[model samples]
Target chain A: MHIVICIKQVPDSAQIRVHPVTNTIMRQGVPTIINPYDLFALEEALRLRDAYGGEVTVLTMGPPMAEDALRKALGYGADRAVLLTDRYFAGSDTLATSFALSQAIAKVGETYGAPDIVFAGKQTIDGDTAQVGPGIAKRLDLLQLTYVAKIASIDLAAREIKVERRSEGGTQMLKSRLPCLITMLEGTNEIRRGSIEDALGAARSGVLKWSAADAGIEDLTRCGLRGSPTVVKRVFAPAARAEKAVQIDTAEKTLRDTADELMAAIFTRQPALEHELAFNSGA
Target chain B: MSTVNRETPRPAAGRAGIKKELPDHFKDYRHVWVFIELERGHVHSVSFELLGEGRKLADKLEVQLAGVVLGPPGEAIGNAIAEAFAYGADIVYIVEAPLLADYRNEPYTKAMTDLVATHKPEILLLGATTLGRDLAGSVATTLQTGLTADCTELDVDTDGSLAATRPTFGGSLLCTIYTLNYRPQMATVRPRVMPMPQRADKPVGRVIQHKLSITEDEIVTKVLGFLPDSQSATANLAYADVVVAGGLGLGAAENLQLVKNLARAIGAEYGCSRPLVQKGWVSADRQIGQTGKTIRPKLYIAAGISGAIQHRVGVEGADLIVAINADPNAPIFDFAHLGIVTDAIRFLPALTEAFTRRLSPHNRDKLAS
Candidate 1:
């Protein structure tokens, strides 16, 4: 059985700074890390490989520096890595991104085998859409099990998997057959550090790089920026409202006195609040 | 509570601003359609929310609001139609079949897209749930239409176009997208973001039974069976009237207990910032932010939260917001109703004491007796 883990290289949000003039993200010199969520996906896939005796392959589509992420995947016990990068792939949305990734996974199938399970993070911190997992599951015709809080069981022989799914009000235990895409929720598992031998093997291993044509995508028009429909016409910082709170100064007063003053001032500004408070003070 | 009549698609406007004058070809597109996402016999609430929102959009455009429900026949599909109208829909289109049961990308996608092709809608909206996101992506891809996910704002422009605004690039910035050239503008909004409409006493919507041309063999996937949640985590988050959510404040792992103590004292639920889960101090289910579960409790106490735009989008639904932080200039104060320029770790205990004194053992014992 072959397991595939899809990851992205995103700028560390803590290190990211916005360009005040252009109102655009300043990626310059900001270090990139494998999406924090994706690390869990990689570790989960490695755990499956260790238990099931299968090979794990890491896949990513990004700039050349993205290969660094794939190598890191190898250091984490993945058997192989593939990098799908091209100039034409720039400015791709989630839809276009899933297409490129699905094509790359298909190419992997030819070189290796059809993946028994494809894993991805719940979402990338950069996009925060969580759509790519479903998109890839759709394009590849794989069963999508999203928001999986735990992999309760996986029966490789039966090609079946059972997991707990998170929902608005409760968790749902969902069971589905294999050849599916499962997007693991974050904090479900801790990522393991690579062993010295694994790190050495990863440093020496070659990363497979593919252009659009190499990934078996026949229509260049349906790939990257062209395939994306929703165009971001513009992006700007949210304007801060030019208003201040009515400061209730009570430095020298007691809590009860301050509370009374607050109620008075609040009533002066919003008489309606007083009515609601009175009505709701006790039902 | 019968289904409403199936009306013809509303006629498209001709020679409008920009929009390329609505090509002589597309002047035929019309109808306000809600996608009733069916799971087992039950339906998701976002479906109702979309119906409520779709009703408003339909009224503004002066078109019939219809719900497109697909499920297995004799599996309570009609009940969903009544539920749709109870929430505020005027029409229902049902395509019932065995293949459509137990949401699979292939069957549900085929059923929905086929309905839209046979009967076109000017606008379509779905809930941004896991199933909704999965099914919407497939349906939109099959229909070759534009879909905006997690939209915070939805309205009609002067040109009668769906103006959709969503947080883009991790919610740091917002971008409004317009399906200027496309018909049946598609969008999905998360649950709890929109207010629930009052259910009508008598739902008088016309139900138009739809034709399911596809069959079981045509659809490849099977439900097999569903594993019910062994441990439910979602219910407590949604129904809690009072919630104490900690932001980056509360300092470290040990400090999160202060929030928990306050919550315990006030009989409220406790949650934390996204970074807390990232830090392994709390479970992801306890995180309260855009990426995490959204909460719309009546009273929300945000301690030490800096109120980043991403986190702000998640908690905007809280009715009464009280922000406590060491920094007076924190963004949380801008939107918070009650602002305190004090340390949360210290102020939290004090507020907890205040609330405890106000509604303590004596009051609780009296009420219980």
Candidate 2:
């Protein structure tokens, strides 16, 4: 079985800081890493390859710098890495990004072997839009299973795969055919550490770089800002609250005293909550 | 608010100056539609919340608000239709089929895209639940329309286009997005982002029944079975009246018990920050943050959490927020109503003991003092 896992490089959101005066993201010093959610997908794909004995290909659509993410995946035992990068693909939203990525995936199928499965993260930290995986599935006409918490079983002869999909209040055990797209939920598995030899091999490996044209994207308009239907009208910081929090004195007070004082302050502020708690405790 | 950036210009240069007329084909697209998500036998409350929001947008655009229900033919669907009307829908679209009994992408997508094609709705709103996201993504892609996910706010601009606002840059910034040229501008709102609309006794309105054209054999994905989460594990944190959340400052996984003990003493739900979930100490559903559950409890007690913007956005809506941390400069204090700069590990048990003593049946009267 051949599996293609799509990944993205995003700024480490935890390290990202907003400029207080300018109210813009301070992008200069923010380091980039593989989108955290995508790592779970990569690790899952690597595990499947290990068990089922198939090739795993890592795919990403971003600027040239995204090669680092591909190489990192390669270190994690991905057999091949493809970087779909082009200036034309800039400013693409989920719809356009999925269009480009789907085209690239189709190209991967033709160049490499046909893949039985396509994997993506449930969502990206930067965009946090979980639409691209399904968009790719629709464009490629593949079955889509999202928020998959576990791969329960795979019947290679039947070309069937079963997974436990995370739902609102429960888990749904779903079975789908091969050549399906899956967006993996986070914390499903811990990514493995690469062996020293594998890390060395990844460092020397040359990523297969593809432009939009190389990825079989014929329609340039649909490749970028021109194709994207959604337009960002404005981005700004949420207004700060008028007043800062009131500090409860804890320096000289004992822990019990502090707790009592805090409770008193809370009851004073929200008398209704105190009454509700009283009613609840009495019951 | 100072506008930091405009990420994308309108598609056409000249059309950008004026409110570009929607293609003549899409001009006929009218009304707003909310996909009423029916799972198991109960309708998700997020659907009703979206209807509440859709009501406002529908009224603003001078269009009818419609609730689209696609489920098996049963009391669930029937009750969902009635609830939609009582919530705010002026019209209800029904597509009942056994194929749609459990949400498979193929049939549900077919039903929704067919509904949009036949009776055009300019805007479509869905809850950002697992099922909704799965359906919305496929439907929007098939129709080649734009869809924004996890929107915190939705409104109609002066030109009558849907302006969907959501947190960006890890909740440090907010961006307003518009699907200018697409018909049925689509968006999904997280469960608790919008206020639940007041339900009223109203007669059901016009019902438009559509056909699900796909057969069971045509669908590739099948539901083998469903395992409902155990009652004790489910975190109904989004709608809880009182919430207590812990973060990495708790130091160890076992210390999460402090958070739960306090919560139990006060009859509140307990949760943790994203890191604890990432650390596998807590379940994903109990995470309180931008990528997790958004909550608006009456009283929120955050212990040991240095509030990042992501976590702040989720709980900032609480009526009263009390933050306890070892460091005085933790960001949680910035937005909290009351803050105690004390170590949560040491202070939690004392607070729990105090609440247990103050709120016990014999001492309940003391709370009033």
Best by DockQ: 2
Q: Give me the runs in candidate 1 sitting further than 4 Å from their true place.
A: A14-29, A149-178, A250-283, B1-27, B38-42, B72-76, B98-101, B180-183, B213-227, B230-232, B361-369
Per-residue alpha-carbon lDDT of candidate 2 for residues B1-369, written as tens digits (9 for 90 to 100): 011112322334433553466888999999999999998888999999999999999999999999999999899999999999999999999999977888788999999999999999999999998889999999999999989888888999988999898888766678778898889899998888888889998998899999888898888888999888998777788989999999998999999999999988898999999889878899888999889999999999999998877888788779999999999877787799998888999999999888877788777766556
TM-score of each: 0.86, 0.94
Off by over 4 Å in 2: A279-283, B1-19, B252-254, B326-331, B365-369
**Residue pairs with clashing backbones, model 2:** none
Clashes of each: 10, 0
In terms of lDDT, the best-performing candidate is 2
lDDT of 1 by residue, A42-125 (tens): 888988888879899899988888898888888988899998988777766666778789888998998899999899998777
Task: Evaluate every candidate with DockQ and list the scores.
Answer: 0.24, 0.58
Across the candidates, what are chain A's individual TM-scores? 0.88, 0.95
Q: Which ten residues in a row have the lowest lDDT in candidate 1 chain B?
A: B1-10
